[model samples]
Target chain A: MFKIFDHTADIGIEAFGETLEEAFEETARGMFAIITDGSKIEKKEKRKIEIPFEGDEEILLVDWLSELIYIHDVETLVFGDFDVKINDVLTAYAYGEKYDRNKHKYGVEIKAVTYHMLEIKRNKKGVTIKVLFDI
Target chain B: MWNGPLIKIDEYRYKIPESYKGKGNNLKMRVPAIIYASEEMLPSIKKDDAPEQTANVATLPGIIEKSMAMPDIHWGYGFPIGGVAATDAEEGVISPGGVGFDINCGVRLVRTNLSIEDLDRKKIKELVDELFRNVPSGVGSKAKVRLNMSQLEDVLHMGAKWAIENGYGWEEDLEYLEENGCMEIADASHVSEKAKERGKSQVGSLGAGNHFLEIQKVAEVFDKDSAKVYGIKEGQIVVMIHTGSRGCGHQICTDHLRVLENAVKKYNISLPDRQLACAPVKSREGENYFKAMACAANFAWANRQMIVHWVRQSFENVLKMSAEEIGMHIVYDVCHNIAKLEEHEVNGKKMMMYVHRKGATRSFGKSRKEIPSKYRNVGQPVLIPGDMGTESYLLRGTDEAEETFGSTCHGAGRVMSRAEAKRRWRGQEIARNLERKGIYAHAASWSVMAEENPDAYKDVSQVVNSAHGAGLSLKVARMIPLGVVKG
Candidate 1:
């Protein structure tokens, strides 16, 4: 599950899941949801994504979201679902199709994911992550 | 939100002493944090985290004097929007957060021969419509000029000079631009392919979210001599372009931030916020980020130059007059978000420092060699843009700005969040309301119009008044919007 929060000059997102990978996947969804209504995105195409990582969960999460932002900008793709696997490195499949302005509506354009107050906590319930974006 | 102790320095200044401890981490600031504001503006300023952010900035290593916030200060990610800090070049560190994501995000004013009386209401409306059609604005707006990879590199290095060589703008425009529109340290190699790809097709596009192209008329002139030097006359027409490097700068900042995030650990630098990730100025990582940042800054200058060219074309097409005949000339361009290496006097000794101005304009006083020769006697022209329907000011830099490292407020800072503004007002309603006030507004989307309602910001008049009272910058002229186009 994921939710959006109001920032004075920007936007914030919080994602939760039972596992780290699940939380990463949900975070991806949450970011896309900010761009457009998630229901409009059809998972017609699948693109494999691989990120080499050996760092704290917070840095890895930022890396994951940044890669998604790049894909969204360069390939004009709006991803709705993510199949993420994590271990020594990250390898996943992003499912979405080309963005159609006629079909997809956009909210505020997020410039970049910021590290301000970025936190990832895993407790008795689950793993949760909070991040901010420069709009 | 900011409950820290603040000592009133004067009617226009307040000081958070160096002994004050920040909210989080309880770090003792290395220097004091000073804010420039009038007594009336303090209530709204205290409603946000501007004071906390300012105090946090003072804790950064090698910060000179004090961490400063202008009257327009508001809550931002790491540093307050209207924050300014100068760090030692040899021992200080450079933080990307201090520069913001939109590198060199700034504003420039262009003077025209025509006055309000020269154009009828119908003509003004037609001109605005033509401009809206000519300039690609709003979200996902692509540029008409698509640059190849090699040509894009030239823009990274040459900045506005590249545009001039390509016949986009006049050569004389460079003199009026900050840093002559190019930083010599910019290196294309430091920029990533992803950043380049995102910027390739966005060269001249006006971005969304507070960025705008407005037609304005000089409504009041406070200083006759300074206004004359700025080529301003009461009721004269002018155009203000507000935007930056767009996606390219955003990606550049994002890419470097990851590097600096690791650098912070490597250098063992402690911080109250991760967003303030930084590296020593002399470190390799810091040098690379600075180089890459310079490229983004140069790209923004080129982007604005190209947009100005298109704006001139739109005017020519609508009025059936050549640009030269229209007397369109750049007054000055100011970068509100940037970090620059400059020489300043410290304790009576001249020293080089990296000055980071997130949402503050450089206000060099009269006789400063950095200002344009044409207006050297009057000082640098500071452009402070207000909200959509509010009044913008043209000011002259004052010598007292030296105390603040030559900086002043950038705009009428936000008082309401975008989400809150959107909830309170409808874009269509806001546009209609502006029309009722005789201000024609054309926006890519109604939501954008609503998000940028004038009521969402503080009164620009009061902000400028604070700056003037503090002797940071002196008001020369005030302008009211005639027509505006936003993306």
Candidate 2:
């Protein structure tokens, strides 16, 4: 599950799941929700994403979201879902198609994923992750 | 969250002494920090973590004078939205956060001979729709012009000159822009291929979020002499373009930030926040980032120049008059987010320093050689745009602003979050309200209208008055939007 929070000038997302990987996937959904309503996006095509571990889980999470933002900006694709596997490296598959402005609707165009107030937490309940975007 | 000591320094100034080392840090502040705000504005300025961020900026190594923030201060990453910092050229460090993600995210104002009397409500709507059609905007907005890798490199190097040479605008327009629309230090090779790819098709486009093109009428004139010299008169029509380098600039900032983050550890430099990632100004990493940043800045200049061309075309198409015949001329363009290396006087001594202005404006006073020769006696024109359904102001730089390294406020600044605004207002209702106010607005997304609800922002007049009271910038004229195109 995911919820959106905000600051005075920007917005952020917090996601939770039974596992860290699931939390990552939910966080990706929260980001897409900010971009659009997220229901119209279909898994028309799949792009395999691989990111080498950057030393820590915090940096890795940022890399994951940034990679998606980069892909969204350059390729004009919007992903509503993601399948992930995390080990020494992060391997994932993003599912979406070329964005149709009329069909999908317009939300904020995020400039980049910011590291400010980024967090990853684990407890008895599960795992929760939070991140903010520079709009 | 930051309840640190703030000593009142007269009416428009507050000082955070150097003794406050912040909450947690081994790095000591090299210089004191000052925020130019009225006594009544303190609560909101301290509402978020912005003041702490301002304090964090003071801790940067080799910082010269005081780390300053304008009256429009708000929370931002690394530096407050209206933060300004200057550091010694040789020994100080340069941070990517200080420049913000949108490098050269700036404003450009163009004037026309036509006034409100010449344009009716119907005419305003037609022209606004024409502009919306001509200028690509909103999510996934693509440019009308496309360039291959080689041609894109020329744009990175030439900036607005590339646009003018390509028949996008008038050649004389260059004279009125800050830095003449090109940073000669820009090297295309320093920019990464990904950033170039993102930029290639995005040129001549306006990205979403607070970026807009507006047709406004001069509503009030404060200093008639300065207003006349700047080619602005009460009741005259004008166009203001607010946008930046788009994805190209974002990618460049992100890539460089990663490098600077690593360099922080390598250089053994200590910073209170990791986002303030930087390297010594003379280091290879710092030089490379500066060159690449200049490319992004040039891209933004070229982007604005192309939009200006489209704006002219849109007006011509709607009114059946050539732009030149309509007397459409650029007044001045100012950058809001950038790090520039220039010479300024420090305590009565002249020295070169790197001035970082994030969400701030460069307000060089009269007699500065950097300004256009035409406005030498009155000083450079500073464009301060207001939020939707609000009044924007035109101000002039004051020599007194030198205390803050010759800078002033960028905008009214956000007083609330986008989500809060979105939750409270309906876009369609906001549009209806804007129409009632005699302002016609066309937006790509209804949701954006709600997010940009005028109430979400501070009262611009108060912010402008604070700057005027402080003598950071002097009021020239005020403009109220007649029509707006939002992305």
Candidate 3:
């Protein structure tokens, strides 16, 4: 599950899950929450993106968010929902829309996903993570 | 974190209360952390969360005086951008965070005889193209001139001297470089084989993002005497080289971070930030890191030297002038991220301390023996680069800088995050926009261009103004970018 906060420019997503995969989905949702007002972006624009990491699970999470950020920058698309599966690596099929400058009131721009404040823990309940975006 | 009130020392200076001191923070800090900034710059400093970083640095073992922040302060990994702190030599700890990922990421100025009158759109474009071609750039970019293990060791030890010996630049250029473009204490033996492997082929490359080569013209002369001393004249053309040791430096930092991280536990050193992991200066770990870091610093100086050599060659080829006729010479080379062992007066006694300047420049004022004889009277030339579209500044160290441990702001600090700048700006449009302003833009990637857009940084004029007001560096000559090459 994920809770979204109204940050000035970027949406802040707080996610909790019983597994790393669930927490990652919430993180993706957080990124989308800031891209478009939840009310504006319907789950209409859907696409599949499966990202493979060269390193471990922690770096995989960063790479996953970095991929979405890259897609946002290169394709000019915004996603609202995320369904991610972590089997050895992360594979995600997400939903979003083409960024309409006229319609989307841009929030804070996150430059690069930093390792600062990045944590993924394997607790008794499951895995918990907190990542901050540099806006 | 300190829970006490922030005591205002002056309009530009403030202190964190003693009540904020945390356990495991040693060194008997003489005063609370101090930061220099105008009213407007303070908000960005706070918003960037650099103040807490400053407080965190104060918690380092053997920290002395006060943890300080410059006017251009912003959030960096372990230390705040423009953070400066010194620790007792025999006991103080050295952190890789104090240096940064881009070890020896610095700026160098190349003075030229050609003026604005000699450069038009076509000529400038031709020059930029030549520079981009001759100078290898971009991320994961390989060097055109490869070096084997032996050659790499020479570079690690000899630094810019190796470049000069290999016919990269003239001997006279060495005089203008910090430590003569080579730090003498550098020990390649201390550097790991993996770091050497990474550095072997990466010399003379510009690498990527924020690293650039810009063709600029002298736009304004603030201190004519200092400008003249620096061989900069009004309207003269110049090439500004901004880069570091590239992969070598990055790998060096990475390698050291691991060593220091483990050292933290081995040495039983307590630090507030994991990124600020360190070991005592006299300890085996500290000496090892210093020696290796010096090698990295040397490699960085050599990297810039090779780039400068190519820049000279590019000018000669494009302008159809011999190197002599082009009259290109190095004005200065200065380092921003490093920690060096030096002796400074503390409590009426001279004490050896390890000065860690993360995003700060060593601005030793006049009379220091380390300064070149030519600049000994006016102090060392401090190069401060603005963004591509805005103006860069040339400054001289002020006497007050010596009081602050020979430190000064490095550049116009980033104001907007890269993502924000990209969202508001189109890379192609920004490139075209520079063209309209009579400036040229050549970048390896759109992301790089957008990240380095002039708007992403604060107004350089204000940054310089604050530096002057803070008594760090005196403005000399301002440079305007004519043609820009970004990686």
| Top-DockQ candidate index | 2
List candidate 2 segments past 4 Å from native. Answer: B25-27
Which CAPRI quality tier does the interface of model 1 achieve? medium
Off by over 4 Å in 3: A1-115, A123-135, B1-4, B21-30
Against the unseen true structure, what C-alpha lDDT does each candidate score? 0.91, 0.92, 0.78
**DockQ of candidate 1 (2 decimals):** 0.61
Put down candidate 2 lDDT per residue, B230-348, tens digits, no spaces.
98899999999999999999999988998888899999997888789899999999999999999999999999999999999999999999999999999999999999998899878
Model 1 C-alpha lDDT per residue in residues A39-114, reported as the tens digit of each score: 7999998888888888678888888998888878777688999999998889999999877656775445778988
Residue B464 in candidate 1, Cα distance off native in Å: 0.8
Listing candidates in order, what is each one's chain A TM-score? 0.96, 0.96, 0.81
- What lDDT, from 0 to 1, does candidate 2 have? 0.92
Q: In candidate 3, what fraction of native interface contacts survive?
A: 0.01
Candidate 3 lDDT over residue span B1-487, tens digit each: 2233456777667777545654344433344688877777766666656777787888788888788998888877778888999988876788888888678889999888888998888999999999999998764456788799999999999999999999999989899998898888888888877677668777998876667899999988988888888888899999999988765676567667666767888988765666787888888878888898999999999999999989989988988998778888888999988888877778789888888888788887886788899998899999998888889999999778866788888988876765566678878888989999999988876656776788888787877788888888888888999999987
lDDT of 1 by residue, B201-252 (tens): 8888897889999999999999999999989999999999999999999999
The DockQ for candidate 2, computed on C-alphas, is 0.81
Which residue pairs in candidate 1 collide? B138-B487
